[model samples]
Target: MFLTPYVERLPYPSRTVQRAIGVAAVVTQAGIGVTGSVVRVTGSGLGCSTWPQCQPGSMVPVDHAQYQTVTQWIEFGNRLLTFVLFVAAVAAVLAAWRIVLDHPSRRRLVKLAWTLPGGIVLQAVVGGMTVLAKLEWWTVAIHFLVSTPLVWLAVLLLRAFNEGDEPPRPVVPPLARKLLVPLVVLMWLVLAAGTTVSGAGPHGGDPGTHRFQAPIETLAQIHGGLLVAYLVVLATFGLALMRGPVPAEVWRRYGAVWAVALAQGLLGSVQYALGVPEVLVALHVLGSALVIIATAALWCGSRDRGAPVSGTPAPRESGELTPAR
Candidate 1:
């Protein structure tokens, strides 16, 4: 009876390789995010002015001064990062499939790791559509939206790698659970709303020639409104964590995320008020990525592991928090 499932698990080195794949996935996903941001900031969204190429006629352009030259390179660079991310996702899925076939509970984790590449493939399609559709609001919004779940799934795979053979962490305390999950979800929502505004707002300048009739002021208001809402929600969580009888480490993470979020929000406001110079805008996106990765790490640390460890405090769990997972 055990032969089939056990054999399935024998194709890979299991935990050791799984951990390496998990780390590589995170690094690649982050690279994709940053490189994509650079492309957007450079107004390179339509760089190729053609899907999957530098131009309609050639791969490497004969003309050095064509708009396609700079834009194609920037946009193609982002695509290259996507290819790297895809490879990492494949490694993760293979590692998971070979490591968990015999462990029934863990089999689902392997499946989830595989889902990431599917998401990235769809993202690449949408990316091409965004340029072909001339940066239409919906296509671009969908493109950015896809990355959030990819990042979240990457977090899940990493968390599973950290889990090993242990049972689920004790049920999270109700108050802390209430505080953390909602805030994390809200942070993601804020990112989604911002994407819509980005697609609709004026590109600094680009060859796409696409423009939106929606007043830039109105779009900025909408994005800023979501930002303020997230800031308030995070503050509430911070207050709740301070009052609730939770681990000190939990409190510290809450504080750190709040600090990053505040800085991000401030940079965003400066970008808006000053008309979003290219450099600051790029930093704003980087700040947003950091906030997401950090909040995810904090959430996994708090709710996913077992009993508290010694000298930390009765409420503090030692083995529970595992790096990014």
Candidate 2:
């Protein structure tokens, strides 16, 4: 609701300035996520063997044959993404601060914009700890989880910047306690399980890089099984969409989620069943992040009520669906 108002009042730039900034932020964050996966894949979590700086004397090593050059790049690349994330966070904070002072609708957007930097700061500290602590699994998991909410905020900011001013909806529908909510929840669960599977595997980021141990295939199998359950729920939801008075936007989201889940499942099977090469594994991680972003976007965009029903007709709703003041 706070964001809704700011979205209405915020001024638009002629050159898609706001959208560009938002997109940059998302891209940077995604880059960070990918770099993280690389760190895990290459067992380079401790390449630097220290944080805030790779080592006491040098930022980038000049001579090192023990650690492959490619491995050095992967770990350093993750660090570089951190810098980019910080810059994006600053730009967003400034933009939100500007909007909050004058516009009522924008106040919340501004507030949320500020939140990203704070989270990043904490993330940076936690990241250092992960390195210092030698890549603890719980720390790693927390670090990974923290990124999602920031990404969610980034997505919200981008959407708000693009949305034009309009009077507040007369009525907002109550969200249904339906299967969709649980389904999304289950998706997250499966993802968490995947982290466990990853941690137990030899390839799970550097054990000293983090707290996790070698990934056990038995655990990986359980994680995979959960993924299958996730697919079943998604399919059931798809069928329900066919029967229920779901909105077009909602339908589109459903399709997108299902598509990502399907792709992720296939990639997972390939990565694990085929002996788990670094390349397939990296794609698997990227695919997971993509699914998370898309899922968050879909969840935000959906509503229990709005618009004209295509054929069968929506139940009478007398709120935002009608004309506003």
Candidate 3:
């Protein structure tokens, strides 16, 4: 009885609301990665000096001689973003659940929606481990690497909201489609190498943090080589696309991927040349998130999933509403 009135007054969420939730899910997922980089580059990785708490005695940041107030807040702020991401994830799950309850045929969306919240939980555990481990290079690398797949899933969730649950049909030619497999794998490789370079480079999140054992120069060369290989594969995929007619949307997405990759490459070059300045390090991390988003968009756009199915009826001019199931 206590909750009945609130439940009765709640309006059914429209398709537009669901799609907006999807978009929010994607943006928040990507935004958190950039913030994590900020924590690292600012030497605030251990700003709170403990996980699940700012310090041993406090959950919130406190004035401490051992840590600067600004640095403690920076790290605590990043931790707080996990809750924002969780909120987006919960909204996505609720939206998908409502749709599936009304139209069972759209049940597949629920699975994708669930992954967002699950991934956020996993990220939280890894983040805590990174702090507990004293910001070890590999733990930090793992923390950053986890975002790639979460970002990929977020993009897929957004695409699902805009399209049907039907099986994907490729719009690109067979060669072009097949080439994307390698292209995607190479993208992950480049990301891993980039993280490795960060591990060995100057920024270790803390002044006394342990770095990877390899020489920074050697790691940089390896990361650069992988990037060059990824570019060649992308160029080859473009040529394959040229062999046959392709959808305009596919071309646009492909161009976006190319544009992001090229700009990221340029930024990486400048970052390296400038001795990995703190500001550029943050920008480079943001660029990495963009590259993930752009490539995921390209992959999703390469396939056709037909039109979206609406769970709720068209809105009445008088704005009378049905309660969500």
Candidate 4:
């Protein structure tokens, strides 16, 4: 109870500040995943030779005979990015807490905000496991897979900033909305298949790391087939939306997803044909992050959550509370 007065006296964050923080959270979350791919393709996964520490009794990279200096720094740099991600997540939580609203909206925003930091902590632990496991294929795959949902949730949190606490109503037709379920499932499957292909491919993060015991050609074919299915479903969903009364915003978001998916497919094909070069591998990871972000935005756009609650107070230039629009 002693902290109540101080908490109330805290300056409220503007809506612009809140949305900016949300965007930062989404970007950092996705960027970290891309950087991780760099670590893998560069064979720097064990540059630190340990977890939560760069080496024995050292929290930073040190001269080691077993790993290249560049590789050590690359891995350490990726590890440092977790701190940046955590900072963004904490900022998101604080910004959400400062938004003035009705009890329900306030509570919901706060709850969603907490997920950002919470997921980062979870990812940190999983990351440590990935390192300690000697860059095992499944562990690496798990680390990447975990980021997908976090990216999705980050987008939802961003959407929540401009919306009320009301239950979501479909902006598209009911059937079109229903089709999204299959589309989303296919997206997940495609990601999983892609990871499986990665496990079987040449890039295992380290020369000593065990590759998944499967023919790379077979895995690639499976992954490609899943991608084809996802594209087909997504095209069908787009057609359904076009045949009905949908908002322009929804159409724009869906179009972005479609464009990103096609680009990603083309990149995947080129990466495969070129023998999965390191640069293209990093680009492919970036494309994967884009796919997740675009898909999540489209999903959010398909739902209508009304407007922000009225009469909520925001901080003014004089440091006094004034009603927000």
| Model 3 Cα lDDT, one tens digit per residue, 15-39 | 7797799889989998998898889
What lDDT does the true structure give each of the candidates? 0.69, 0.67, 0.87, 0.85
Off by over 4 Å in 1: 1-17, 57-66, 101-104, 164-172, 242-244, 305-325
lDDT over C-alpha atoms for residue 289 of model 4: 86
Name the lDDT value of residue 174 in candidate 1: 61
Top candidate (lDDT): 3
For residue 54, give model 2's deviation from the true position in Å: 1.1
* Cα RMSD of predicted structure 1: 7.5
How far out, in Å, is residue 39 in model 1?
Answer: 1.6
After the best TM-score superposition of candidate 4, give how far the Cα of residue 197 lies from its true spot, in angstroms: 0.8
lDDT of 1: 0.69
TM-scores for candidates 1 onward, in order: 0.80, 0.78, 0.93, 0.93
RMSD in angstroms, all models?
A: 7.5, 8.5, 3.1, 3.1
- lDDT tens digits, residue span 137-246, model 4: 99999999998888888888888887887888888988789888888898999999999899988998998999899898999898899989989888888889877899
lDDT of 4 at 93: 74
> Candidate 1's residue-wise lDDT over 175-292, tens digit each?
6567776777778878877775676656522645565557777877877777787777767766666554677767677777878888988898888888777788678767777787
User: Which wins on lDDT, candidate 2 or candidate 4?
Assistant: 4
